[model samples]
Target: MTGAPSPGLGCVGAPRLLAGLDRMPRLDRTAHLGVHGQLPQLGPDELIALAEDIELRGRGGAGFPFARKLRAVSRSARARDGSTAVVVNGSEGEPSCLKDTALLLHAPHLVLDGALLSAAALGAEDVVVAVTRTDVEQSVREAVAERGPAGRRVRVVRLPERFVTGEGTALVSGLNGGAALPSGQKVRTSERGLNGVPTLLSNTETFAQLAVAARLGAAQYRTAGLASEPGTVLLTVAGSTVVETPTGTSLAYVLDLCGTEPGQGVLVGGFHGRWLDPASARASEVSRKSLAAFDAVLGAGAVLPLPQDTCPAGEVARVTRWMAKESAGQCGPCVRGLPALADVLEDAVRGGGAAALDAVRTRMAVVRGRGACSHPDGTSSFVASALAAFPEEFRDHALGSGCGRRVLGALPLPEDENPERLVVDWTLCKGHGLCVDILPDVVRLDADGYPAEASMPVPGRLRPKALRAVRRCPALALRIRE
Candidate 1:
């Protein structure tokens, strides 16, 4: 959970998102009034037209066009027979990301204003603001409460702080009182979501940007950032502070602002994002067009620089393990393949030679494009990019001996707050093999045809399946214990 906003939030230079943010400590109604003046009341058509004029993409990892999403939801809502719902995805599950929490905690009214504006535009009466942390939940509820009757229309739902829970469909699923997991199929949330009606779901920052753009209009908003990607973006500088910087800010400048020096590789985007070569990162700017020139993504506005003292290979290994642990474990690829990839990477990091290198390549191929969600794909990107960016370190670990440095936990991992593991009561087992039949991804049979792989963390996606398997067991052998 985020603390007081005093030191944690601000802008580096000229603040757009953070503009009028500093004057008041916390952006209450008075502070919000001082900062943004007033919410720009826009009709659905006007809002969509203004979004198109500004060419605003989502601030979320997908970088989808906001105008397109708005139109889709509007069209879907018109075609459907039920009411539409709007969701504010405030679940900042990425470990390196703090911008969403900071913005919600500080300038929450702006986010709410954007949501309400979108809800009104989409002809949606029900608005759901989903957050993960207690403080953020309280802050958003308080912000909503400040609006009186209008605020009461917005429903704030608290969610689990899992990495994939912030996913649009997952948020919808959770809000609908189902398991908070991405579906095993591709379905646009706009067409069918939130009580099975059309839903306009976007990141917290995206809504905040909408509020800013609604107030600033197209021309004024374009005055600050790049021609290709205009407006200020919120960046969660992992080692430093959460600041709202212009879209086309230089990567080197961002690094410098975060107290990082040049010639060190930086991980642009969040954990699911890629790694940039040191020189390439410095030469590039933080815009979609600019980074696309180098075939990179400016994902989620998370810029984490690699610590100079830490071994790049070791750091990758450590982060890979965490990513493996974070797997939703629904698909076979993510559940089994991630740990396999992590093991191979660790082997290569520990000087396990050519076999391990071959295994890494092979396993990466095996894991990619196999998950219900992008967890497997994103993990592959993270690992593949690390291998490409730090070839020398991989070479040293593979060819010579090792980097000789211990794995420094440069990247952050959520503390193991929930250490629950799935276990099977071997004594109660009768070799039924029922558990294997149910959740083949997480459970397998031994050579003797009994259930094996007893102790493991059940992915949020697979919990229902796991529970089904547990109950279906004739001997009542399988159980989950904390």
Candidate 2:
């Protein structure tokens, strides 16, 4: 299933997950064999020890200790008297992210090597790689086919392409034929996942690094990056180009790689990530530990640079609106509070007074940690960081007119195939109070007694009510669409 790997534009330093990607050859079975040779067969205890020795943490956003996750699943399997399962998550759900897909597309064999190696170590019979895009699926599938019987053991599940569908538990749910949404309750995927069996689920980059660490051993693996966070990390630079740079690489250097200088600020960790001013961003490094000082994490390897020419307040407003639309609509706070936050930001951008800023603060407080998932919390962090990071620009928008710069769209929000955005056909509308009355949480009326806007792409919780309102609309003005 492997195509020719893309020749990367060479690493600023050492490359691991993106090793030799500059050659631009997909590490197919033969090429993979030529480069890394055969995967070393390691017993479960040995692999876990090696991970511990190298302090290999999950490359996923949380940066959970890899050794701990392996031990948890292994111990759980032993207790249940049944084998565990492994899931290599490649569902790059965030619009500003593509590192997982890039890793698989260029080096599918490496991901497979890690997954297979992990399966043997964990005594798991089933291994699944969940991906959202078709290209990634094809690349990994071809690589699997090349492995023949060895590849047959690895299953590639194409998941729904939604922002939250890539959540660990949600990926597990989808793999088991359930809807691709995070569970309403807080449950670890390692404890009860994949048909109620303990599952070892890690990001694609984590597994790829697992293979690299197993091959290099602990001492060699620690050769690059800081002692605390060793090895290279694959990053999707600016939502477009992909690079594998050493951990702790300067954000300035990352901007250089992306061919853009630091502007007003830079967004680390994608839409759900935080914003840092130019100076703080340049001082910060790519590692999770380093980013923690800025109250940020290296979430999903997304690093976007915000241009100064663009109106920062307007850009933040647009992204906040998008994040609000992406909500699963599973929780009350996330469903209602996000749009409120976006509205305040937009109002500030449009020259609303200090009241808008107060509303933003209040709504941000209301949405924190009150969701079934982290959407509310993450979205809150995003908006709050925008305010804190660019106080001057935000204040200008709030107090005076805007910054006079148009929104340059420095932040990219890729279009979704199934948008599910809420819309109103104003041409067909007579004054309709049904929508406003039925879905009070979302729909509101304008001065002319017409439905204004319900924050298009109504949250999932209100969609049913929205649909009911749409159906009952005498003028048929309201509709939900992609």
Candidate 3:
């Protein structure tokens, strides 16, 4: 588990999911069985009882209770054809988070045991494990092969790695042979998922936790964590180390243990998570309740401690721009509002003064609760929290000045894919001005009604509008280039 996914792969008290990493880095079938013992097969009711007794919750962003999901899918199955499917959302698409990858890469059997046990109890014949990386896929495949006949019903699928690709609806859609994009409408995975059947979908660590809970039973599982919240949580600390820290552990201790400190502040979650001031970060604990007390979320278990040297406003701008490009391009808020927000933030950081800073605040309010998914709201939160947490720095920048420190490029962003931009077919031009009405910001008519900038590096936010312009062009002169 310490193989790059986490450099300092240690634990607080005792590691649960990351139990035997020191002795056997990669727990093959023999070592896995020896360390964790056999997978216990529990009935549906018994499984739900164990989850409820242990107060088990998903390790994913929302932290929904696993028992409630299991019960919902169970009822749906009985109401329908007794058909249910189990999905392991191992898609660690976020660039900073790596606990799921550590678990899948090192302890694949533990995850499989949790998934296979659930599938058997649910009476579901189909089980699909969705991943993003190829090597991680190979590790899972090897684990399945080690299981032999027991792993027949389990199928592994690799999806495109993106910020929102790991969402429940997107993963479900991808499993059904469709694009890995979230549905515009709300999708109840427990009701109809993976080919129109009741499905029990959960995060990678959630399932792994379930497997550990089953082996130890609820009583033993309760012994590991506090009375308020039981069991250890997997935290991707400082974007480099993955620690199996128990709930209610001090956040400051984790950072110090991982050889980092809260400089400017701490980003408790990944990109979508909130920023806490040094005091809040120091006082905070690892549990959901503890983080929630400070209006922060223990989301995805990514505890990123920002360094003091880098400019806070510039770092926020860099992340905002990257998130704008990661938009699903589904709604107006995403296709328009996010890029607008990014532009305003960049402007504010580069001495745009009060006007740009006010624009940033206005856009934050406008984009909240206005997207098909939580993507827009998440981006808005990241900006809003930065503004709140580091007001003095932002105020200085707003007064036509900067922090003088360079943007150290501390945050993570993936390599850019082949993004599309508008292209004009000069041969098929008819000088129609229809394109101008559709894309006012992009298509400026020259002396002749033609695009002035022939090859514009179109931002991801305007791709949808550009398409609209291309379709509406009366001359059929508009085209797209990769």
| Candidate achieving the largest lDDT | 3
Q: What lDDT does the true structure give each of the candidates?
A: 0.80, 0.80, 0.86
The model with the greater TM-score, 1 or 3, is 3
lDDT digits (tens) for residues 6-114 of candidate 3: 3458688877898899887799999999999998799999999999999988888888999999999999999999989999999977877888898988999999999
Order the numbered candidates by lDDT, best leading.
3, 1, 2
Query: Is candidate 2 or 3 superior in TM-score?
Result: 3
The TM-score ranking, best first, is 3, 2, 1
TM-score for each predicted model, relative to the true structure: 0.84, 0.85, 0.86
State model 3's lDDT: 0.86
TM-score computed on alpha carbons, candidate 1: 0.84
By summed lDDT, the worst window of 10 consecutive residues in model 1 runs over 1-10
Consecutive 10-residue window with the lowest summed lDDT within model 2: 1-10
RMSD of each: 9.7, 7.4, 8.3
How high a TM-score does candidate 2 get?
A: 0.85
